[model samples]
Every structure is written in C-alpha cells, then in structure tokens.
Target: MSSQLLMIEDDTRLAEMVGEYLGQSGLHVTHRADGKSGLAQLQGPEAGPLPDLVILDLMLPDMDGLEVCRRIRSLQGPAAQVPVLMLTAKGDPMDRIIGLELGADDYLPKPFEPRELLARIRAILRRRTDGGTPAATPALRFGSLEIDRDARTVTVGGQVADLTSYQFDLLVTLAERAGRVLTRDQIMEAVRGRELDAFDRSIDVHMGRIRAAIEADAKNPRRILTVRGVGYVFAKQQD
Candidate 1:
C-alpha cells in the first residue's frame, strides 16, 4: 500500500507541486491550507484512516506551526504518535530545535529539493517499520531505563518515556554501542543513513530531548553523556 501523508501548508502552488510530485512516487498526499483545518482533519471521525506522516509548515495563517506540533503531541491515541516532518522557511536553527523538543520527528528548511524531502520521508517511515535493530535481543536494559526494540518504546522506572521516533532510534543506536563515544556524524549515519551537516546542531537538540524524557536530571544526564570535544556516549552504567 502507498504511504499516506498530510501536508499542512498555506502555499497553494507549493502544495499542489508537492502533492503531484510525491504522488508519482507511490505516496498519497493530502493538503490543507491552514493549521486549524489540518488539525481538525486529524481529530475528526470522518478523517478516515490516520495518515502515516504529517508535513507541516512553520508559518500558518490560523496558528503557529509550533503550537500545532504541541497540540498534535498532546492528542490522545495514535494521532499523537504520528510522525511529523516540519517545514520552515526560516533559517534559524532554533525553530527546528523547538519543533524537535515538541516531538516533531524531523524538519526541513524551505527551498529544499523535492528529492531530499522524499528521502527524509522515507527515512522516517523506515525507522518506524524496521527501527534499524537487527539483533536477536528485542530489548535492552540499563538500570532503571529499558528500551524495547520490537515495541519501539522506552521506559524509565516502569513509566513510559515520551520520545519522538527519531529520538528513539538515536537512543537505540547509542545503546547498541554502549560506552563507545560516537561522533555526531557516526551517530547520525547509524540512525538515519546520512552524515551530519558541519553546523547542524539538531543531533544535540535531540539528545537533550531524549535526556529530558529519560533522565531524572536532564541538565546532569547520567544515561547519555556528552564528551567535551567529540560527540556523545550512552553510559554503560546508569541508575
């Protein structure tokens, strides 16, 4: 079956172009002009099946895209877990960071190539399906934290930890190589099959979010420790 995608964008021409382009690649694309209607479709009973992913624009006529992301994450049931790939014209990294903090699976700046968008979409969906974990062990335990590969869930102290799909995969990558310091490029390649941009701090932002979800003290994270000049390591010993 073709993957379903919802695009909440205010640009009519852009939406049409995206829809037609992605449709040719065996993806079903639905478009809404503003945030409210897009969100209503997700919340409405007649919205049919939930979309596999959402392509959201940062600037919207009705509401800010960040607010939309926050609301989506707050929704009950499967809708809340639907992966979001944020779009923004702004070059500011803060917008992307904020979106990630609010549970967006990924973000793309405007003026992006159609192929890159398609690639990002595929990567996110692929993570959801395979999780890139091929080990016989279905779960990994480190003190109070538990990562279940099959279920794609993380728990700390028996309580479910809320992490975006991308973050969860990142955690899994680090855990799979526990105690080994992985540079940003290595970690990004491991999880997403891509190298990190020289200036892209998105990985660090995601690590902070993961720490916030799983660590008792995010500022003093015990499970994921940052090396001064290199990258990050998933501590083998954790409480």
Candidate 2:
C-alpha cells in the first residue's frame, strides 16, 4: 500500500507540485491550505485513518506552525504521535529549533530541492517501519528507564515518556550502543543514514528534548551525557 501524507501548506502551486512529484513515487498526498482545515481533517471522524506523516508549513494564515505542532502533540492517542515535518521559509535557526522542541520530527527550509524533501520523508517513514521490527532484544533497560524497540516506546519509572518518532529512534540508536561516545555525525548517520552538517546543532536540540522526556532532571541528565568538545554517550550506568 502507498504511504499516505498530509501536506498542510498554503502555497497552492507548491502543494500541487509536491503532491504530483511525490505521487510518482507511490505516495498518496493530501493538501490542506491552512492550519485549521488541516487540523480539522486530523480531528474529524470522517477523515478515516490518519496519514502516515504530515508536511507542515511554518507560516500559516491561521496559526503559527509551532502552535499547530504543539496542538498536535497534545491530541489524544495516535493522533498526537503522528510524525510532523515542518517547512520553514525563515532562515532563522531558532524556528527550526523551536519546531524540534515542539515535537516536529524534522524540518526543511524553503527553496529546498524536491528530491531532498522526498528523501527526508522516506527517512522518517523508514525509521518508523524499521523500529517496529522484532529484534534479538526487543527492549533495552537502563536502571528505571525502559526502551521498547518493537513497540517504539520509552518509559521512565513505569510512566510513558512522550517523544517524537524521530527522537524515539535517536534514543534507540544511542541506547543500543550504550557506553560508546558517538559524534553528532555518527549518531545522525546511525539513525538517518546521513551525515550531519558540520555546524548543525539539531542533534543537540533533539538530545535536550529526549533528556527532558526521560531524564529525572533535564539539567543533570544521567542516561545521555554530553562530552565537552565531543559528542554524546548513553551511560551504561543510570539512576
């Protein structure tokens, strides 16, 4: 079955172009012009099954994309867990960082190539699919924190931790390699099969979000520790 994608973009021409282009690759694309209608579709009963992913534009006529993301994350059950890929026209890094902080799975700046967008979509969906496969050890436990690979869930002290799909995969990558210090590039490559930009701090932003979700105290993270002048390590000993 073709993967379903909901693109919440106000740019009619761009939406048409993206929909058509992605259609060629066996994806079903649905477009909603503004944030409200897009969100309505997700919340409406007649909308049927939710889309596999969402492509959201940062600048919306109805609301800020960050607000939309926040609302989506606050929704109940499966709707809240839907992966979001944000499209940002702004050149500011803060917008992207804020999007990630609000549970966006990824972001693409404006003027990006269509192929790059397609690749990013594939990577996100692939992570979701890959994460469900049964493994030798389906779950990882570090002290009170538990990571279930097959179920794609993280729990701290028996309480479920809210993490975006991308963040969940990132946590799994580090937990699987517990005790090893992996550079940002190495970590990105492990999770996304792509090298990180030399100056990209997206991984750090994501790490902070992950810490907030699973750590007893985000200020003093015990599971994921950052090495000064290096990358990060998932401590073998925790809590």
Q: Please give each candidate's TM-score.
A: 0.95, 0.96
lDDT of 1 at 33: 93
Candidate 2 C-alpha lDDT tens digits along 114-219:
9999999999999888545465565899989999887888999999999999999999999999999998989999988999989789999999999999998899
TM-score of 2: 0.96
Name model 2 segments beyond 4 Å from true. 131-136
Ten-residue region with minimum lDDT total, candidate 1: 129-138
* True-structure lDDT of candidate 2: 0.92
> Model 1: per-residue lDDT, tens digit, 1-239?
89999999999999999999999999999999998889987887547789999999999998989999999999888899999999976578889989988989999999899999999999999989764556666689999999998888999999999998899999999999999999999999988899889999999989999999999999998889999899999999957
Per-candidate local distance difference test: 0.92, 0.92
- Please report the candidate that would top TM-score against the real structure: 2
Give the distance in Å from residue 224's predicted Cα in candidate 2 to where it truly belongs: 0.6
Candidate 2 backbone overlaps, count: 0
